[model samples]
Target: MAIEEKRAWIMAVVTIVAYGTYLALVLNAAAGAPLGEAPYVYAMLWTIGGAIVAAILLNILAAIVSPRDGGKKDQRDKEINRLGEHIGQSFVILGAVLALLFAITGLAAFWIANVIYLAFVLSSILGSIAKIVAYRRGFQSW
Candidate 1:
């Protein structure tokens, strides 16, 4: 597999794992209390930070393991990335719109924040999946 593909796999897996861990921790903590009252900000921050650190570490490890790849992103890699980002960004936009609507409707801050966080997670997952598919199959020109 190309290094980009490997990176995509890493990102997808790491995002899922980090987010899953955060969910488990938050849910466990909130078992007796309401979700809104749970300690979510810290959990979100920690999970996001963890994901970033994990991705960086894993990418570095991958590079060291396969020194030949050298993380060279070519034209195809760039195109695939652009396509994946474009596809994945839809969720972000939706989430923003929803957040705005929720805010306008005076919804609780917890729901809005969670919606945004979920959108980010979904975006990463979908984007990584798209990149992986494009790499495994073939990227067709528009």
Candidate 2:
């Protein structure tokens, strides 16, 4: 497979794993675990940190695999990332808006809220994975 393809797979895998972790955290928090934050806050932060760390580690390892060649991302790579970010942002906003709406109603159970929050995070993760796939499939350029 091509380098970009490999990168996409790596990203998708990490995203899936991160989302899975988030789901587990949400479940644990919902069980009243005194986790640091009410129910989803700490879990959300953990998910963010995990994603950041995984992405950073992947980049670092990719560089170590070929330091000279990995030093810079070409225009195509940059564009793909930009587009992916755009998608991810949409997911975040959608999640927040949904949460706000639910909050206004004041009817959602704690478990429901946690699940909604997790759904939003998963949306972003899936968005990123979709973008990578689109880039690889030639649906997205650069």
- Candidate achieving the largest lDDT: 1
Report the CA-based lDDT of candidate 1 relative to the real structure: 0.91
Candidate 1 Cα misplacement greater than 4 A, ranges: none
lDDT of 1 at 125: 96
Query: What ranges in model 2 sit over 4 Å off?
Result: 1-8, 25-44, 107-120, 139-142
Candidate 1 least-lDDT 10 residues: 34-43
lDDT for 37 in candidate 1 is 80
TM-score of 2: 0.65
| Model 2 lowest lDDT segment of ten | 1-10
Question: How many backbone clashes does every candidate have?
Answer: 0, 1
How well is each residue in 8-109 modelled by candidate 2, as lDDT tens digits? Answer: 566667768877897786767657655434466666677768887987788677767875565666677777777777776776776667777777787445
Per-candidate TM-scores read 0.94, 0.65
What are the per-residue Cα lDDT tens digits for candidate 1 across 1-142?
7899999999999999988998998899899888888878888899999999999999999999988889888999999999889989999999999999999999888889989988999999999999999998889969
